[model samples]
Target: MAFVPEEDTHRSSNSTYRAVGRADQEPLLGKQLTRLPPSLQRPEDRCHATYAIFFSLGIGGLLPWNFFVTAKEYWAFKLRNCSGPASRGYPEDSDILNYFESYLAIASTAPSVLCLVANFLLVNRVPVRVRVLASLIVTLSIFVVMSVLVKVDTSSWTRGFFTVTIICMAIVSGSATIFNSSIFGLTGSFPMRNAQALISGGAMGGTVSAVASLVDLAASSDVRDSALAFFLTAVVFLGLCMGLYLLLPRLEYARFYMRPVGPVRVFSGEEELPQDSPHSPLVASRPLGSHTPPLRPILKKTAGLGFCIAYLFFITALIFPAISTNIESLHKDSGSPWTTKFFVPLTTFLLFNFADLCGRQVTAWIQVPGPNSKVLPGLSLLRTGLVPLFILCNYQPRVHLTTVVFRSDVYPVLFTCLLGLSNGYLSTLALIYGPKIVPRELAEATGVVMSFYIYIGLMLGSACSALLEHLI
Candidate 1:
């Protein structure tokens, strides 16, 4: 889906804006303006800022835990074809991967669920702010749980203690949203295009790290220990996440999504919180018929858009799991050096990052007709993306099932790199653009919802691909 232009009715103090693609620009712009009420800079908020920084650090630290695929692979691969006793799957071969992912999908969605409920309550009887705060609390609760539950280390026994990994991912994904919105409230909220650049840059940090882990895994004499190092990297990031979150000024959670309440200064944890960023307007309309408690729960902005982004990521992630497991197997099968093994993932990540950067640049510079209107012009780029996405979804990814790319069909290797660039660019654009679809307040919910959708897309397309592999 593409970003809708800001309606003509939207106005802002930033005199730089001209008559945009004429529909109303959801009131996101003027938000990033440095001005704010005196209360925002209060000495009290400074103390709150400390915790927020630590929180961001903790979230970032989770990146290395990579157990999501590393350990999940242990079960998913074995279930279809157990190569040996070592491949029997997690928690004693129960196909437990589903349990963790499913649980993650549901638990991770709590903020989204609460957002939907919050919106509904605002429409009917309850106070929307209460719902928002409650949801935020619940979200952060789960995040902390993860740090404790998921023991991050390099122990062989730790390979599948994914129970902790499961809990940790859910918390990080949700809590990140909880605090991020507050940050958006702080930094004169960024626009859709700019936010994308920042987020891609932020996530790219991890992509680079993932590739490094791949190299380490390949370089090590023992793959098991390498996997441990990988998990530990995540822990370091988690600590970093905590630190970033600590820097934010804690504004009252009341209506942080829509109209500015003041400096809650936070990053976008939600998929999209309406801001100066071409953020979408949440529907003000109430439920139609009798009130049976809407089946969708509380999510609005982040759930739908976040799901879309996450689904795409899932497709991308599918390639990841296959890359590591299959490549090692291929090296053994064909007798090649492990150096290329690291290079494969590293190269793919570079391509994706490159694409993402290009997309952001295009959005930033290509101002439309009436001078430089960054918002509307950037929104248009999302539609033209079909070509690249098609190429990504259709072309087979490079596989190192035994040795190296040199021995594998040359076709797959070349296309794999191309796909990397395409997916990377599209993903960056998708994340930036996705948030503009709903109300600003719901950005956090959107992030996890997107994560859920990402998993679905990955499951649907990848399951089929894997099935084909099974058959062949």
Candidate 2:
């Protein structure tokens, strides 16, 4: 029996420590991790491990997608102004055909970071207000940095020379950092009941993305340059950050998810929380029925276990869309109707977002957590739904693209949209489960869970894009 922490506050992390998820999980999934391995089995250690995962995910997310895509697009520019009339570069068609992966890779990692951080916050002992403020700050900072960087010149940009245009590059990296942290805080801190409210805000944020894309596209001409674009972006981000801080509670804290489920709150006048252990860097309290002093290593290993297969999947998949964007150049240059490679993704993103929202709404309604219901048994339910998609991949094309609508890809478009929605819902549901069942010390321990499916999607999405081009 896990005991609750009456203080209901979050722990802090100045240094990376080991804190993987606990082995014990709720029933219904039949997916409980057995007694945590010797490598990781302590509460405090688990939290620390999760921190490493979150930061790593952010780093991975920062690799540029447009960097690859624009290079592919410039294939034509090179051909047009070639040194010789007889031009030779990789197949123009091949490059354009597979450009989607680049964009996918670029976009995929950021979201993973966001989800990881938000979920981390969810499970942490930090006050919800603090978490929410952090989320707000991240969101605003991203917008500001992007807007500000629009004015910078990256004529000779390279990963090695990123610091040369540090302002622009910083915005890119910072966006991932802030986004991931905020989302982790939000997801980890907000309770089961509050998911939809948080999601509703996310849905609105998508609208902002749509608007930003439009504003950006409209402003770009023959030259893809904006003078105050970065400044404008920065201004918006800065203003929003201030506004966000104000909207959030001045002082608040969170209950540790790994400990036990309990109501939590905080007031304005506060500096720090009651220390979990006076000697420990972050104050930690043991739950109700545990009998053990903390072993630093034990805690760290436990946290690493949650994302076992998922983290690898994330890294591989994250680079997919960028790969797709590069492929797109091949198709676009050959006069494929889908010229810029933006239409499919923009369409996919739009459609996927709609589907994702629907899935989220469904999950929220299904797992609403009523008074009589202590836990939702739908973790397995969601997992089961995804099984067919992965298992039946070989037959997917036959079944999915049976009709002209699907072959013409209207059907695929519609189906993928639904798939996105369903996937999003499941992801949301899984995140909800990770926290609700864990004990306090491990509550905010965010592992590789969010990163797993997200990057896998990118990997698979890119693979599918490239495979289709290879096949067709």
Candidate 3:
């Protein structure tokens, strides 16, 4: 069945048909009707432009974080020899260089959760346009500043630089959270495919960063140059996202779906008044803030799906990048570039992200174990098995639990692929299904709530990852 706006559901059937009949008689109303596809007739995506834009926006959401984390060499270079000579490489004994990933995880995720809470409260208070655009601008500005700092040597000021870098990470992470949540909320009103597109784009963003890392690793000798190029690329993409978002409203397909759905009014012997018309019921029905559905009801409806979403990410974050990145290649003594420079990037970031993208893409074709199906949560729980699998891989510098059961490189590769594929497929399903299970009016808020679940999962997982890292 075609999607109908929530406002149309409030009206009696007879009045809706009568309004449609009367609207057919007026040229302006008829044109508006044609432009705004009928409730029964979905509009064409117009060369899939809207879909592509949403995908790109999805890419924009995660690209910054991906760029930041994947630039391991740059972080190492900057954090290296803070207490020693500048000519020395990253000190193996430096706590900052050693635990930087955990610190980054904490710095990024803590603010993200806080910002998401603020974002959820401000959903109806601030326009989505303001929130999304503002976040994008802030993120772009941070990347620009970061790009500039890449060339400015901070050898003498390593501690200061480290502190500033963490602070910047926190700010950018917060901004990205708002941008991602706002965009996810906006997609709730559109078809499910748009949401899928957004999630798939996020996976693609990781893959893009991984590829960029590999390229930079091969092509550039200097970590600073690679980092500068990386941050500059983010600047360009964020700028592109700003432009594409501005262009979104100009598309008929997006405009038709993105229109505000509110109570409709019937007029005698005239076309139905637009929602913004002076006499429209929406104008006097309630204050703007009152339109926000209470959070409890939405939470009640999607609690199961929310749990699945949160747990899926919790398990993912617990192992990925944190534990997975630390897993050394089994044949490190070979001195080959594959073992030295490319192993972690290839097996961990690139493979996982590519598999994750594949998993997300699979949902567009086949959505199994439907939203209400008990199988969904069951599958989520089964992913717990992946935790020990990753831990048992050849993670290095182990003081405790030093046994590596899976010493072969193939084990990490296979486990990582499974982690990415399952994470991508299951997480995408939970996200897309959350909004659909709620009333259309609450879809946006549900989207925000669902996002909150994801970040909460991330926050908890990031914390646990540190503990697990220490135990291993």
Q: 1 or 3: which has the higher TM-score?
A: 3
TM-score of each: 0.51, 0.49, 0.86
Per-residue CA lDDT of candidate 3, range 158-277, in tens? 878889899999999999999999999889877667888999999999999999999999999987888998999999999999999999999987886777765422112233445334
Output the better candidate (2/3) by TM-score. 3
Tens digit per residue, CA lDDT, model 2, 306-346:
24224323322322222212222223455654545454445
Instruction: Give the poorly placed runs of model 2, Cα more than 4 Å off.
Output: 1-100, 103-183, 186-189, 199-207, 214-235, 251-342, 368-406, 446-472
Point out where model 3 deviates above 4 Å.
1-41, 82-93, 263-292
Provide backbone clash counts, one per model: 89, 117, 0
CA displacement after TM-score superposition, residue 391 of candidate 3 (Å): 1.3
> Relative to the true structure, how large is the alpha-carbon lDDT of every model?
0.39, 0.36, 0.81
Q: Per-residue lDDT tens digits of candidate 1, residues 1-472?
A: 1232323223221111222344643222323222334454212223434324322332342233233433333334323223345435444444343333343344444443343333433322443343334434554454354434333332344334545555555555444443333232222222343344344444455455556556665577654455445555555555444433432324332112134331122233343433454333233334234322232433432353444445555455444334323322223345454334443444344344444345434543332221113433343343334323323322223332222324433333454445454444544444444433333333433433443444445445444434433332
Best TM-score goes to which candidate? 3
Poorly placed runs, candidate 1 (over 4 Å): 1-189, 250-259, 262-320, 323-334, 338-344, 347-410, 434-472
Worst 10 residues of 1 by lDDT: 8-17
> Could you tell me which 10 consecutive residues in candidate 2 have the lowest summed lDDT?
11-20
Candidates ranked by TM-score: 3, 1, 2
